[model samples]
Target: MRIRPTSARGGLPPAAASAESPAALSGPDGRRLPASPRRRRPDLAALAVLLILGGTAATITLMLNGSARVSAIRITRQVTAGQPLSRAGMEEVRIAGTGIDYLPWSQHASYAQRLALVTLLPGTLLTTQMTATASEGITPGKARVGLALKPGQSPAELRAGQRVQIISLPRQDPGDRTTTVLAQSALVDAVSDPGTHGPPRLVNVIVDAALSPRIAAYASNGQIVLAYLPAAH
Candidate 1:
């Protein structure tokens, strides 16, 4: 007997036979699979440009907000009614969203020589409503008078623009022991601090011109006392 080699079914080697068959790369439905698509890398330059634009927009928005603020005037120290406005008593501050009602630092000169219309506390925002001219202090038929009051004669909490009554206490004479009211509804114009040597405080009051004589006599004789009145509404 003679030995012979067996031939493949398609007359090709097994490896080459599998390679040429369509079923090797086909799906279960016998459709040929498509080639995989290539992935694309990100554009770094475009991304950097977008980031810079976003940051610039944010910065512009912040700058716009900051520019909306204005420099306004504020009181640095306590100011009494009738006291003259001075630069030392005021300071400039940056305020936002204040509208147009406040006094700005640029307009300080217009109000510097003016007087305060009421008691202004520290840190108060200066406004046109809080100031007035010196001529406003002396109204028609009113005269300002000064009185030197001892410690117990005047109210400890006395301030400018306060309403008070000028009272005349009884004298040392045994024949007359009557207390009289010299003037009523007197407006306090100004008050000075007590002296270091224990002297009496000086208070200036605006009263009716007709009552000036009586108030002067009583004040000079040290028989006058100040009675605090309720604030006018």
Candidate 2:
């Protein structure tokens, strides 16, 4: 039998022995494989936790940002529908909470002060533009009537659109002690200036169709005096 070098075993050379050592086996191209595939480090767990917590905090903050409240606005004057509103005439107002306040004013509200101005009350008229919507409740009408005064009669002698009690004496014949007082209401249609014949001051009055005849008869006599009625309650 031929004798090989003493260091050789099973036909492997000395160089192969050094390559089989643990350090060399752990190196690249080693048949024993490198560092057990380098276990994925567990240190990344804390970073994942931080990211999750941050996302949760952001979500909570976004949920708490909205609210509501009641508001008030002022009526500048006796506003009739179809009339324009002037800034000089109107003012801002505020209202107390009834129960909830939807769309509460921001920190930058224009009328933060002047809390004395409360909600609008009845008889407080608002301009058409001040109204929430364009639609209106008042209706317009025609059939214009005017008041005419005789010479030397003062305009004050005519009361526009008033209710009065009239006492007519029967033809002076004095029959049946016939003293009849007619009581009715009439609107002041119009009145003429004492000196002018061209046209009279116009007044608008609303009355029932039946009452129109009686009013026309009495008014034509030229002896009638007009009176104004107090506004209805």
Candidate 3:
């Protein structure tokens, strides 16, 4: 019998079969594709843009969740030391909430930092207005004076008749290096807040006539720091 070619015999030859398969039809670069299959090219720019937008949204969300802003508060009526900052005493004078605008500037510390400086306890009622009035005499004594207490100060620790000491710290004098006693432990006799009615009562105390004049002079020139102390025996 004569040997016949496979294609002639209704079967493709080995070479013909190999050519029809996908591997044989591919290009030298390997990227070449047959008509039956295709590869898609991704848009790099579009993917990058999406990533940036997502990051921005996440940052904004974090800032919003971490910080909050509050409106400036005022004495709607009056407040006292040893008193709480009650809702009735203050109203959110302005509509404000925490956000980017509310954030403190870089020059100043955060709102939390300033808040730490607050010595007043919560719920402290404003006892008296700090004043710079003339002293009655010379010896150390307590006088009813005025104070401009900042908003959100606590006066709760204060009692009506509690004894308190007032002392002024010494500061550096540009002229001399010596530190002089600004004020020593002075006594506060009483405290009173009239509320919306009238002026709060000034702190009063008994002191020598000589010290009275000095107290008056100090109030006139420097700030008066009030301190609460234990009751006398």
Candidate 4:
């Protein structure tokens, strides 16, 4: 029999014996095996746990904060002041909670019977001020009167929801500066532009029912002039 070179460590060659002396390295198959078992790094394991915990905490926080969402009314179109809330012009939407006493969608029927205190633009969120049911409109004790106005009679910048004071201009004597205040504070429902020709333009204003006749009389003779109210901001 031929004798193979050996080391003091037995079976293993001098090179293998000097590199590793474990029992796993005692056979020829041991040279093909790893010196130690593979294990996951503790740092990577901790990072994975932190990621999972962070995601779970974020989910829980969102669940808690999302509960403040509420169903409220949102205006879908322009609604003039003193006009009833049209069902087609409004809709219900989910939104975050608000501190204002905003009108809820559940009270649609109640506010539908009421009138707006101010002109509401498109996409406006409904509020209590827009849903006042008292006699703050051109109904009950109010009147909607259309006035024919020439240039200089009303401000060109006048628009709906503007509060104005209607005055009857003095007679054309140059010496007569006495102007009669027909309506103290009337709400302008709508006003059309007079354009450049200085032609008569129509203006619809809401006034007390008692003042409608006088206002119409002055308007007929083109003596009606509108003064912007300082009370409106």
The candidate scoring highest on lDDT is 1
lDDT of 1: 0.81
Worst 10 residues of 3 by lDDT: 109-118
Candidate 3: where are CA atoms >4 Å away?
Answer: 1-156, 169-187, 194-201
Q: Which of candidates 2 and 3 is the stronger one according to lDDT? A: 3
| lDDT of candidates 1 onward, in order | 0.81, 0.40, 0.41, 0.78
Model 3: residue 174 alpha-carbon error in angstroms = 8.7
lDDT of 1 by residue, 78-98 (tens): 777656677777888998855
Q: Identify the runs in model 4 with alpha carbons over 4 angstroms from their true place.
A: 1-62, 70-136, 173-176, 230-233
Which 10-residue window of candidate 4 scores lowest in summed lDDT?
Answer: 129-138
Q: What would the per-residue lDDT of candidate 4 be over residues 1-233, giving only the tens digit for each residue? A: 98878976577887777677566456688767557977879999999999999999999989877997788888887766655566777789888886777777998766654556778887888888666543345667889999988878888787665668999998878999899999988877767785946678788998999999998987888899999863211
The TM-score of predicted model 4 comes to 0.49
- In model 1, where do residues sit more than 4 Å from their true spots? 1-9, 12-35, 38-60, 139-233
Estimated TM-score per prediction? 0.45, 0.32, 0.26, 0.49
